[model samples]
Target: MKRHAVPAGAMLAFFLTLTGWPQCASAATPDGAALSALWGLPFAGVLLSIAVFPLIAPAFWHHHFGKVAAAWALAFLVPFAFFFGANVAFGTLVHALLEEYVPFIVLLTALYTVAGGICVRGNLQGTPRLNTGILALGTLIASIMGTTGAAMLLIRPLLRANGNRQHVVHVVVFFIFLVANAGGSLSPLGDPPLFLGFLQGVSFFWTTVHLALPMLFVCVVLLGGFYALDSYYFYRREEARSRFVESTPDSASFGIDGTVNFVLLAAVIALVLMSGLWKPGVEFDVFGTHVALQNVVRDVALIAVTLLSLVLTPRAARAGNDFNWAPIEEVAKLFAGIFVTIAPVIVILRAGEGGAFAGIVHLVNTPSGEPHDAMYFWATGLLSSFLDNAPTYLVFFNLAGGEAQKLMTTGATTLAAISAGAVFMGANSYIGNAPNFMVKAIAESRGVRMPSFFAYLGWSSAVLLPLFVVTGWLFF
Candidate 1:
């Protein structure tokens, strides 16, 4: 059966924004208790999620929940190996440092929210860019706006511009590679992995300088080769159509909307930045629950803005663009299916120390067999693509530091690389990240064809792999 296409950018943008919660507290030494608690929640959540799935629905074994639960749990727990590997070193830091993982999650959520609001606003008219131009600039825009935002913003125009052609699936597939993943590597707002790094200490400016080269490399390859392929498809499509009555189909009347949505999108992003930048030395209770002002304010604002956008957006605008709630709901459904089931597995994995599974990364790990984050980046990424990027990101983030003396040097840098890889490439597979499916769902609505899970990955392995290998060399 043909699967759905959702905006990879919108979901990613929403999720990243949700996670971009700022740290309101001053720098305090992290103690193991807080870090332990952060690690334990997913571990426990995964366990509970799994234990209840079969209990709740034993007859539902063949569904996405049952199977994804098992896989999610596995991916969730993989972080513990890093925790355990660094157990000895972490033993000292956990008891001492203030250990703040919340910041990471908040930043991620914030980014996603911003992307979703902007991208989901409306559709665009067709532009006159050639295939190569579209691939290059389109993917670059994908990074800043978000692969979801870029895809959401561009996919329709690209499709409409090529509406006269056939066999356009390959073009969309390659777009998924460049626009979806590789493009969003620069900032935390651009991609989740980089956001984790921002909180962890890699400066936002540094990431751009480091990642720009790799991003350019991939855009070139996808645009260059895919142009050739797209041209062939265009020719064949034209030829096929010519055999019939060569009639031009009706096109969009440059139906552009959503200017306020862009503003709303900006406001949400401002809130995210505010949350990240606003911190207080004070803690509080709101009606009997312990809460940080930063967390409560940011979360509340995000929800409010999201609701307001929906209510305020003209129905005519949405309908004109064929907008509906199904894409978001579908994302919610598939993702919830994943979250409910992967609870236990992540719990188990979130408990260990760094290097717990360092041994598993001997092949294609590191530049020269040295302990490298690139290894963890691709490894965690492979699972992250099929699993949820959140826990996958956390496991690898925790894996970056606190290893034994033998692996101490450059571990932080390696961690950053792994962080980028998992978050970035997790979007490589349809089931890997949430936004990939969003694009599929949306494309289907517009009468565009999307690939199956395995089919999508084939494009990634063939097109994105070489580019990322360069990313490893250039960025890591």
Candidate 2:
């Protein structure tokens, strides 16, 4: 793609191009109403999802079009606005200046293609009481496969594995916690926020060591708690399974066809890191002019990886394995819907409570005057469950890194809250994280209906919320 210029005049003009411009005037975003302006795109996306998905999906989904649409719209609309905006030279380049990490992540995770790479299925004749085991397995996949891939690949089986229960909503809620968001905390490949850190001078190793502990702690608690719920539900479903004792779980297995794809994904990570670690603040101008080299390189890498993956991954393997473009298609369509619908509200927020809305970020205070590293670990996480975790994480991540103070908070604590919050609480609602929608889709295709968006959040408030608070207290 050719490069474009961001004239000095366009900076102000760009702000004016936005629909609502006053809400975030006093915010710490440093971008005036820029981020506030883009909020409308995702809101538009929500409306589009409702209008379209119902018209297209088969009769099987008639009962759930409403819940599914709400969830899908939330998933796509949030990220869509960011990614769609990033494609612009001015938008991405300017955004990078905030911390220089977010655009790095946006370019690297392209996320579109990663949605198809991982999955798991249960063997026939197996008792689904093994659901707890599967959830643990899904957690590992979240780090390795990326949440989109892991969720798309494993969600069906998880629903089926837990098929016999009545109170399965709690099970799905914990799945969102451990499988969708918390499990994805360790690697940039795991969740978008951490991926931003990777693109910023943050080390992958540091993330695993520092960030992994808190996420693991939360996952463990949820797994333990969910397993109890799963057990109770299993009692309800025993009769159902007994009636179908001949029930053979459709068998499922895992393999990448070649280890090359994993290696390539690693290469993408390396290239993204190199821009941050070695090149530090370079953006590719493409033309003779000097712009940030990393921006160009990151986007180029994303496009290249996406195309090459499509070409090299063998079409037959994808088809024979039941891999299809439908999932990604759904993301694109639903996100488009979100982008259009949410455009207005984003402007309103920018014009309204935009400034004070930043109360979300707070550095932890410890008596020793050292960083309370676990703060982001818990805070970003807790809010991520309720708020749009991506921006919520960013709001806090940005806040945490304020000028060094004599106070107990420090950079370490700031980073912790950013990482923890971004990854942990994103599981709080079906709308909390992206993979949540995919899991819902996969489950619906399998005839297992997920809870409504608000209903799922209710489950989160009841189960995962208390569990997260405890984990947050213990760890952060």
Candidate 3:
């Protein structure tokens, strides 16, 4: 034990050095109000890299995307550390990792792991009705087990069921629209943004009550659109379809395997709920960023659950599901760069009327300072489409007075609009939500030709934009 201690200490030192941990106690963030829009170039570069590299250099991106992400992160960090001092850079880095990115990736990884363990074993085939049914079911449970969990659990089976289809991109796109984004609008547990609202004193049921109508509206529209589109393609395929052999045995029937993972999934949900509900009033400061005790416990316990699922899950279940770490790995690597690069953007947004995006902040208000529910929906949504929806939700939440009670009562409409935008518009792009990318990656790995980033944007713009306009006019 004593001999191992020295090597462990050395490894810890190496890690701290590698991560550039702050050596000073003072942890200062950038002054968002003083910063220029030029600081956002790296973020733009990251987005462009994600959007373009796949099209022009698919092999390069497949191999060196992580390096590209690291390069962009350093593009921000090197300049930031040089201008703002290492203390500030390291401070913000610690804050982003410990407070935001770590917990986020941890939760996602846990969901991916546990869901991977539970394979729906049996013979299944994709018809328009069956596909729509699966989408509807996933959307319904998304609010219960989270979009990430439900997406991970159901995407594989859906892909397998439709493995024979040549034109299945629209199916995955609608999956993103419904199961990955719009479906999560009904509860805090369903999405990150609403959960942030919950932490800010918004009642747990507030979203469920206010956003239910908008959720149903968008989901019904998207699902119906998907059914029509799928039916058209299905019938079209039938006219010239191949006589492909059925993959599964006829004796097999539809049923679930790895039942224990359902319990593990419940445990995951319980841990998340507990972190939000249990207030231990304890915290640890890592380089001036305060880390709460309950969150720490929750993240740690989630890691344990991830490991437990791996160990306890039946081998056949995972094998049948074709579960691998590639999708989660893609998400983890890409989002690390995203979270880091978006740090300055979040700070600037947090600065409100004084920040670089003052016009954006002001867009949510009327001339008389009253909250504009329509603008709130569009603003929060448009930004959320390009930014992390959780912090985007927080930015607008604070912009709208940051008072949960008032937002729930007097500003209820505004709050509802904000919630609806953050959750629903996350379907607008592949990078809009974590699950969107994960779903895309999983679908692509399973041989589905997902749309490119801009193509997906085109799909959402065509499918979702008009509905949002209607929703805003009708409800906001």
Candidate 4:
């Protein structure tokens, strides 16, 4: 893949905006109530570009996606700076970058770098049982190593196992549904949204205790469905071939290279936990955004961890995994636009009952002023399918009365719905979660004909939407 160069003019303008104004003395943030719905168009534009461009013009999109993302970002920022003062615009940009985007890309970098180093060695048949087993195992570890980590660690092996098979798209689709999204519901360490919840005072084990039943239901249904579907295709292919023989020796034992990465993975998890647990109350204000000491430590430590993995892991291991920086670079650039354009949308949602989208706020409340659990689930979910789930989760978290203790107790069901929705429904679209896109990119790079964006949406709507309905009926 060719790297897109950042234009000199854009870089100059961005820096000028950043240093154009002094920091405000007060901590007052941007008021969503003052903004118009038109502020959200840039966000919609970027999303539309992501959805439509690759399908219509593959070569152009492949070569220029980063530039396109930057263009959309500037579209929002320029107007924002004009309408709202440069001070507000610059502060918002800094907050989005320092507080949200930086940490997000850092953690993803650590997971991707470390996981890419640990190559699974051995060849196996792509039998129905074997493929299903890999999915199950990946799902199991997703919460521990994060959905990104587990997906990076296992996807290559799964693809190689099915290299000789036709009708393998469903395998990768189910992998995204299970391993990349649904599997990370149990722990804050598992998903970005949940980790944000943890940082907001929700206990580490709260998701484990509350979301267990819902996660199990989705996993069991998806796993069973995958087995049956894979079996049907497997037999069909076998009938066509007349005989399906193992391509590699049965005696070739399975093992893992780059075992040191496992320790690095654990260190990544610990650094996350440490940031959440060890609050020194020391913070530096960078352009009006509060940068905490512990968070800075954690981000720095994670960077070191990523560099160590690159140094310690053998070059052969990464080559065997076909690891390249393209996926991470694509994620970083695209999500930078997402994180920026999404600011006004989040603020509007946060303005509940007084902001531009008060209708949405009303939908989640009943006539008696009580919380509607079902609406919370669907609203959080549908938006999460398109927006970044972490901020989407935070939006509903505040809407549900932002008290962690109360949310964990009296508002427990509402919290679960929001959490489950943000985590699980991320599978509803390719861009719903970071790992979903990475997994798709990796599979396609390996020659798997993954579904198109809308086609994948059709799959999720047909398969996952029904399951979600049943879950709402039974649990919510």
Query: In model 4, which range of ten residues has the least summed lDDT?
Result: 1-10
- Once fitted onto the true fold, the runs of candidate 2 whose alpha carbons sit more than 4 angstroms away are 1-129, 159-171, 244-260, 285-291, 314-317, 320-379, 402-409
- RMSD for each of the candidates: 11.4, 8.4, 5.2, 6.0
1-476 in candidate 2: lDDT tens per residue?
45444343334444644754322212222233345544444443454444344447646345554455456445534474354442332332233333333353343234435434423333433234466776788798777666765665556556655554444566665667777788887776777666655544466656677666777777887788877766665556556545534233444543344234565666666666566555544333321224556656666777777666667665544543356555555544433333333333333333322433333322343554344556656666665564445545544544444322311134664576667767777777655666676666666665666677667767778876677677667665
- Residue 6's lDDT in candidate 4: 27
TM-score against native, each model: 0.66, 0.66, 0.89, 0.92
Residue-level error in angstroms, candidate 3, position 169: 2.8
Local accuracy of candidate 1 as per-residue lDDT tens digits, 157-268: 5665556555667767766666666677665556555554444445445556655665566567667787677656555545643442222255334344555667766775
lDDT digits (tens) for residues 1-476 of candidate 3: 11111121234435666787534355688788988877778877877787678879989999998899889889998999888887788777777777777887788788889988989967777788989999999999999878988898898888888777667888899999999889988777788788768766787778889988889988999889999999888887654256433546466888998999999989988987888778767766666677777878989999999999999999999998888887788778777787688778767876777889878766787777788899999998987887757767877887787889999999999999899999999888886777897898888888887888888999999999999999999889
Which predicted model would earn the best TM-score? 4
lDDT of 3 at 249: 49
TM-score of 3: 0.89
Give the better candidate number (1 or 4) by lDDT.
4
TM-score of 4: 0.92
lDDT of each: 0.52, 0.55, 0.82, 0.86
Residue-level lDDT for 263 in candidate 3: 96
| Stronger candidate by lDDT (1 vs 3) | 3
